[model samples]
Target: MISLGGKPLDIAAFEQIVLHQKDINISATAIKEVTRSYQFLQSFSKDKLIYGINTGFGPMAQYRIDDNDRKELQYNLIRSHSSGMGQLLSPLHTRALMLSRLNTMLLGYSGIHPETVQLITDLINNEAYPCVYAHGGVGASGDLVQLAHLALGLIGEGEFWFEGSIQKADKVFKKLKLKPLSIHIREGLAILNGTSAMNGIGGVNVIMAHRLVIWSTLLSLMINEMMEAYDDHFSVELNGVKRHNGQQQIASWMRAFGDKSKLLRKRHEYLYDKKVTEDVLVDKVQEYYSLRCVPQILGPIYDTVLNTEKVIIDEINSVNDNPIIDRKNKNIFHGGNFHGDYVALEMDKLKIAVTKLSMLADRQLNFILNPALNGKLPPFANAGRLGLNFGIQGMQYPATSTVAENQSLSTPMYIHSIPNNNDNQDIVSMGCNAAVMCSRVIDNAYEVLAVELIALVQAIDIRGISSKLSPATKWLYNGARSIFPYFKEDFAPSQKMREVKNWLTETDITGHFHKQL
Candidate 1:
């Protein structure tokens, strides 16, 4: 079990809990600190005017509330703001949001009761997800609408995704012997006012994007092997001249992956051995940019993914709510810690990087399908008679269109801020929107890579070079063939493409390569 509040959660621990469904435990010291903060807030706010404690929230903060209506005011805030509309986030993302929120609360700065953290922990361990919507968060004021739905479920009034179906939160709570969160002080504002929504989604996006970079690098090497391209492009001597760490690392991975391959050619052996005697050379001197610039193209993407991971982990561990309850200083400080500019900017950068990766995959797929380009395989890599059957020709259109869609979606959401909340949040950050769009781009990249993998396997078979592949590429070829065998005849590729996509997402083909980094 991963323990929270003792130390900040890193990407590895977050991945294990969110993706692998590992359980969590709260530290004893953290629980004591949380109780101390709660007690301090309760006593300190009896006479003073604290925001969200006696006064209203956001633009309505000027209106003072009565002592008797303070507890009911919290309930009203949660109920009124539960107006999110759109598709529900997948259970994976919902669990991530829950974990992110729980971690922040355990910092003992939210002034939330210890019972609130316990309920969230139980919900996460039980796999009972709150129904969080995709649309309603402008990412300003801490994803107000989206988190309101999370707060709604915590109060036993909204829906819970139980056993892959939507059920009443009260029903699930009763069935699992879990109690709903009670309104102790500002639990509504404490739950709703934070950056956890965007942070959680952006964290998952960063993880998937990291995996995409690894797969992209592997595929780039495999294609070079299939085409028998020159090895000088990714050589240590060539990339070591560049100052970028990402480029050097990618070059290293390429060298390691292609070390055992029999298909790669050395430049000195082919060209530098002797001078050319013919006017028209039989061998092409260099490959297309897509095949030649693997390090340069994917290096920035690698750096972007890693940088985004750091920013997201920092956000996850930060106390991102307003009115931070500092018991040590014996003061309650109100500020805009709830703003999401950091997450918004990082998500935007990540989507742009992932979109470019998809473009590279699409171009590589196009290169393999066009026989005129490589002068090796038949048109469209058709194994059957040219006129009688079309091989993988129909699959290229979706890949192209999908990459185009990703390109259009890569426009930055950070710059598209619109004033809302009566202009109180005039310069808001659309962080959640950026995270969601980045996720779509990552998903699209997977589809394109799946198509490219199938075509590469077919090209390998048509060239009759399957036996000469390196161990890493050969393992990929065999694994892909198990999901989709060598297809020469004209057949529908929709189902086969999906199977490969699922395998790519579910499988970890780059573990050994990842360790080298």
Candidate 2:
């Protein structure tokens, strides 16, 4: 059970609630807060009231909603606002949003009844999520349209994703033996009026970005092995001079990941001096820059991941509803908790880091594909002239496209906003849009890592035919081989790349001896 007393929602509990399908429970105090907020709304009929409860919303606020019809008014708000234009958000995202909205309302500040919170909670603990569209939230007036669909489902008016189809809410509620919530004044406004979609998406992203950081570090390890970069670059003294925390972390990781002899041997021997014959040229330089500079390039990405985590954790705990009930102070105030600037900027920053990470993976994959970079391992593209050439050629186009799409999608969404709610909302938060864009960036990054997995395996396979490669390379190589065996001839690799990406999700690399997880 997670408490929601104007504190950040617990994201790990949410993950278990959805991924593991856990039960839900609300605190007694949370139920009281919602009751107090509801009572406060009921007490203020004669005073100049808020537009959402007794008056019309947005441009229509000039017209007052009648007391007898307040319940209908809230339902109408939800029905009208369910005007989302795009496809539905994925089931994972929809479930996350449902839980987020429930947790947000538990702060007891949204003037909703305890039953309302319980109703939403019932859907979640019962493995039910209201079907919400992918678009229609600007993030300023609290994800408006997207959230409207969620509210619509709660009131038995809209549809829900059940089994495989979008079923009418009433039918599903009955079929699943669930109780439908009775409409209350301003319940729709409160439910659909916060940054839940943006927050939900941001929560998932925190996990995805964290995974990408691990994958990028592992990819960097693969490149480092192929490049034979100077272990001295990872030396404690070299990084301590700058005192960059992330740099120090990267260096430490490199030190742990490098050849065991590199740490023990007092004298570093150049392969050129020891092994290279008179046939080589250009100093037979130690691996390309892509492989050599991973710590320098991706160390900052590690720091960005850390910052993104802080943003999500802070947002999760904060009460994001308008018209918060300060029952402790006996004050009812409506303000700007609906604003999504906080989540949008964090997602934009995450996208930027993830974009660079995918590009880095693609570059490393490129080096592994080339024999010159692989160094006496395999031919360019690593297919090894099956008949003549095949595997590498087909895979290259997809890798290139993934990198380009990531670059294009990383353009920040926070800087752009369109006024909505009839100028009442003149400035908006593009937080929901940021979530969508960031999700796309992650999809693109997944494919990039997939291709890198193929290339890393190939580089190791050819190198290993003679002498065993670094222990780290073998770990990654064997891991990839389990899911994606070496391709000696032409074949479709889309399936293989996907397998590698999924492996990273469940496999804990920190448990392994090698750094290339």
Candidate 3:
């Protein structure tokens, strides 16, 4: 079990749990510290009002509640805010959102009891994934609707999908011989008051974006080696002139693949090894810029993932609760720790990065499919036989459209905001929108990557790169070739591409290399 405090925790570990792996542990010391914060908040009688814990939520913040009605207040919040509409998030996204929200509260500054955190953890560990819808989160004043749905599950009033059936949480809890826990005044506020849903979707996208980075690099090399491109373009001496890290990295991977090409033994001014079958010829297409500029284009996006990871780590490790307890200072301060600007901007950057990659992939697919542009590569998905088979000509149409759609969604939601809740939600982060939009970007990327996979595999086959592929490239190419079975006849390519993209997402492409951190 991974140990979490109101401080250090592992994101990868959290991801595993959200994906239905295991539970996290809280150190006794951490639990006690959290209890201290909880008790201090409970001691309030009068004059020491806590904003969310004892007061009405959001625009009703000016209203206060009597202590006797505290329990009803929390339950009422959950029941009322459970107003999210539309289809629920996918099981994957829902699980991830729960994990992210729980981990955020694990920072222990939320003035919630340790028991509360433990119950949430227990619910996740037991596979009681509550129903969380895609709509109803404006990302300010927290993901109120989403969190309430989650809370509703815990209180046994909402629905859940467990053991492959849609069942009530109360039924499942009882069948498992467990009981849903009661809520305290702050419980609803604690869970619903942050950017967890956005973070989770963005987190998964970050993971997938990371894989595409390496895939792009590998693809550049494959295209270069297949064409017998001049090594002069990728010379370290030449790349050093530009000194762009991603460009240099791409140049290195390309030349390295070129070094391993079956056609060429070595660069000029060097002795040629005797490993030659002179079958390779000049590539008439010369490969599009999309194929060649993989590193210059996708590398900085990799760098963006690195920076975004850092910012998110800080956010996750932070005590993001309002009314932060400063035990040492013997004081508490209510502040705007709940704002999602940091995550929102980073997610926007991520959308820009991943969305650009989709368009880039789409561009390459277009170059490969168009006979006019595709060199000797067969027309439109290598339909080997011409008129009888369209061989994914239609596939490329939507793939091209997908790229433009992703580009359109890349507009930063953080920049656009409308005041809500009587200007109380003024300066909204709209991270809820960003999170959902990035999810769309990721889905579009799935289609884009799928199209590229189909195109690349087809290109390699037409150019006979498979026969001359490097060991690593050959391993991957052959592996994917088995799943796709060479696309000999024109058929729907969508399902096949989705399966291929899913495989890449699950497989750790980064593990194939040992590079500097």
Candidate 4:
């Protein structure tokens, strides 16, 4: 079990917990801090006018709530705000959502009861994933409605997904012998008022983005070697002069892949290697931009994914709820820590980075499908009678369409805020939308990469030189070929591409290479 407390939580461990369903617990010090903060908040009276305590929320803050109705007010707040609608988030996103929110409360400033904190932890430990909806989170005031839906499940009032089926929260709670959570004053607002939803989505996106970068580098190296492109573009002498760390790293990775190749040839020595049966013609003095600029294009994507990961890590460890309780100083501060602008901007950047990577894959796919540019390979890598069967000719359509869709989805969401909550939130951040868009872009990029990998592998087979492929490329080629049997017919490749997408996401592509190396 991973214990969360005063120390920093790494994203790797966080991923293990959320994606792998590892158990987690609040640290001892965090439990104490939660109790202290809750006791301090409990000391407040009905007339004290703390935000979301005895006073109303948003534009309704002017209305005062009586002591007897404070609990009802908090309960009603959750009931009304649990208004999210749309397709539900996947179980992984929902699990991350709970973990992010729990991490926020564990900071000991949200004034949430320790029991409620444990309740959330228990939900995660039990693998009880609430069905958080996609819509209703403007990301201005902490994803109010989306988180409220999460809170609704905690109180045994909404639905949850358990054992691959949707069931009522009450029934699941009863079966698990877990009591329904009670919402005291300020607890409802604390739970619903934060960037947990966006952070959760952002967290998953960051992981996927990281994978995409690695896959992009691997595929680029594979394509480069397959085309027998000049290795000077990724040479240390050229990239080292730029003083760019990302470039240096990608160049080094390319060298590792290229070092094992028999196909990588110097420009001047095309006939020296005796392994050649056919003299591959050198048509151009220099490779095209897509083939030559892998490091340059992927360098920024690496930096962007890392930068976004840092932002999301900090957001996960922060106390983003309103009315932060200063237990030591006996003071309260009400501010918009709940604002998701930080994650919003980073997610937008991630979408763009992943989209560009997808475009690179699309460009490579286009190049390899054209006989003129593909080192004399058949058009679309077709080996059969050209008119009787089309090999990968039709597969390019999905890659092109996804690239176009990703281009449209890359528009930033931070600049398009509309006023809501009676102008209390005059300028909002559509962070949730940015995160969702990032997720879609990542998925699209995966499919594009899958298609590119399939097409490249087919090209390698068409060349009829399995011995010429580098060990690293051969490993990837074998791994992918295992899942997606080499295409032999003209049927649509959609089903095969989908299966490959799943395999790529689950199989640690780069990690496998590292282990083999």
Candidate 5:
């Protein structure tokens, strides 16, 4: 179980709750703080005009609301904004959204009632996900529309995903023996006015992108082994001269991966130790840039992913709602804490980094498929009779096209803001769009990597070098072959490709090399 409120939540613990379905325990201190904040807000706002408690939201804040209709006002805010339209977020992402919102409230600055916290906790533990959408949030003023749908579900009015199907919120609540969240003061605005939606999606993207990098690294090493490429490029002596931490770390991993391999060659052992040879050497002196410059290429991607992780973790632990309710300081300050620029910028950088990784995988796939380039392996690595049968040729089309699509989608969403909400949200952040697009890019990269993996194993089998592979490469080869056995005849590869993709998504190959990032 993951513990909240006592210590700040990090990415690892967040992953445990979202990906592993671990239950969360709210701290006693956090519960007391939530109660204290609620009481303070109730007493302090009785005679004062607060942002959402008394006045209207956004441009309507100039209007005054009477005490009699204040509860209805919060309800109106939730009901009016429950206008999200598009595909429903998967249960995984919806659960992450709930967790992100919950963590922020647990900071005890949102002035939310203790019951709100308990209800959200129950929903998460019971795996009843709100039916949030993909297109409703512009991410300025914090995923307003998408989170309003979440708020709608909390009030037991909208649809929810339970037991692998959509059910009405009231029915799900009844079956779970739970009560809907009652609007005490500002639960509606509090739920809608935060960066949780984008933060949650971006958090999952970071986890998957980190895995994508490790998979690309392993695939790069395997390709080098297939070609018997020179080891000097990833050698410590060569990469240490570069002043990048990512470069050095990637080089270290490559060295470790090739430690016991019989296929990797030392340049000096063949060239320097030997006497004068033929004027025209048959071996190519250096490899293509994709094979030789892996450390340089993937180093920036590694650094970007790490930086993105830090920013996302920071956002999740923050109080992102407006009108900070500081019970300790006995004050309420209004501002734009709900803006999502931090998460937006990080998501843009992350998608670009992942897109580059996919480009590398595509290039390596091309190198192995063309005999003119690698000087080995038949066209498309076809193991059957030449020209009579095709091997993995059709898979390359989707891989290349998918990489092209990722390149197009990598256009930054950070600067694409359009003023809306009656210009009240001028200069807004399109953070949710960025997070969603980044998710698509990560998903596309996985497909591309899956195709590359299939090609790598096929090349290994064609070369008859299974015995010479490193232990790490052999593990991958064996695992992949088990999923997609050796094929020499022409057949449709769509299903086989998906099986490999699913395996890549579900398997945690990073742990075999080092601790997960």
Candidate 6:
């Protein structure tokens, strides 16, 4: 069970709740705070003008709303703002979105009723997920349309995905013996006005990106063994001189994973008095930059992923709603806490970093495929006749295409903010777009890694060097090879790639090597 109060939500705990169906409960203090905020807001009537409670939202804030229509106005706001397009978010993403929004409201700053909060908890705990769309959030105004769709489910109006089918939320709520949530004075606006959508999606992406880093490091180690790379590139003595944390950490990981490999050579052993004869052709003094600079290149990415996690977690824990209700101080502060630039910018950086990681994997895969460059491996590591079977040659096309797509998607979404909402929402932050794009890059990167794993294992098998691989590298190689065997013939790799990718995501290869990272 995860407690929602006072403390920030960690990604690990969030994963348990989202992926494992862990139960959730609001803290007693959070309950008390919510009640207090709601009571304070009740003191004001429609006659008394307040930002989200009485007046219209955005530029319409200048107009005063009357008494009877206030509740209807709240309801209408959700219906109007629930405009979303494109593909729907997965159930995992919807649950994460709900969890973030619910946590924000639990801070007791959104003036939400206890019933409203409970309803959100009910949906999450009971595995009733709202169908949140991928588009419709500008990232400023706190993913209005996306969260609005989420809020729509609470009112028993929108569709929900339950038990593997799309059903009416109203019918689902009834079957579950739950009542539709009644909107109160600031409830609808409070739900819609926050950065939870982008933060939630980006939060899960952060976890996935971190996993990708671990996978990249692990895969690079296997490639290192296959290419017989010099161990000096990952030496602690060399990295310590550089004084970069990520570089040093990566170097340490490489040592931990690659040190046991029989194929790796010490730099001094190969470099000292080496001659270039036909029998002793020293074609390379050191590995290429992709193999040699894994630490330097991926080290920064490691730091960036961790840093982005910090910002996203902080956003998840804090209240981002406008006109924050401070009942104790009897004050209301309307500010840009709802702005998603923090999440957007960090997500953009993560996308760029992860895409670069895919490029590294692609380059390394190229090295292992080329006979001239890959330590004299066969063209495509073909065990059979070369022309009859194109080994891993066709696989490179998708990896190259994905890297190109990642580069195109890496354009920063935050800088492309377009003005909307009658200029009231001018200078918006496209955080949701960044979050979506980041997820796409991460998904594509997974395929790239999966393909690279296939090629690397083929290289190991073709070279008949499985006996010489380090324990860790062999474990990963065998784990993958078990699911997808060596491609002696030019069979379609899509099925094999999918199985490998699925296994990688489900297993704890990254967690097992946590100490290294």
- Better model by lDDT, 2 or 4? 4
Model 4 residue runs over 4 Å out of place are 44-47, 267-281, 513-517
lDDT tens digits, residue span 370-392, model 4: 98776668888887778788888
Worst 10 residues of 3 by lDDT: 264-273
Tell me the deviation in Å of residue 382 in model 4: 0.7
Question: lDDT tens string, model 2, 1-517?
Answer: 5444544456566656655567777877778778887787666544656667778877787798777888989888889889997788887788878877887777767777678888887777666678898888899988998899998888887788877778888888998787777776678888888888988888877777766766676667655655444556667877788756777787777666555522122215655247656666543344466665667777787788778777776776677877775666667676888899989998998899889988888887777766665565555445556547665657777888889988989999998988867788898879999998998898778778877777766765655531344555556667888898876776777777778878875564544444332
Candidate 5 ranges with C-alpha deviation above 4 Å: 515-517
Per-residue accuracy of model 1 over 162-256 as CA lDDT, tens digit each:
98899999999999998898999999999999999999999889888998998898899999999999999999999999999889888998898
Stretches of candidate 2 exceeding 4 Å from the true structure? 1-8, 45-48, 257-286, 381-387, 465-473, 505-517
TM-scores, each model vs. reference: 0.98, 0.90, 0.90, 0.95, 0.98, 0.96
Q: In candidate 3, how many clashes are counted?
A: 1
**Candidate 1 regions with alpha-carbon error over 4 angstroms:** 510-512
lDDT of each: 0.91, 0.74, 0.71, 0.86, 0.92, 0.87
lDDT of 3 by residue, 133-245 (tens): 87887776777788788888877887887887788888888876766766654777777777777777767666666767777666656556555554565667877787567
TM-score of 4: 0.95
lDDT of 5 by residue, 140-231 (tens): 89999989999999999999999999999999999999999999999999999999999999899999998898888889999999999999
Measured with C-alpha atoms, the lDDT of residue 330 in candidate 2 is 64
Clashing pairs in 2: 7-317, 8-316, 8-317, 8-318, 9-316, 9-317, 369-381
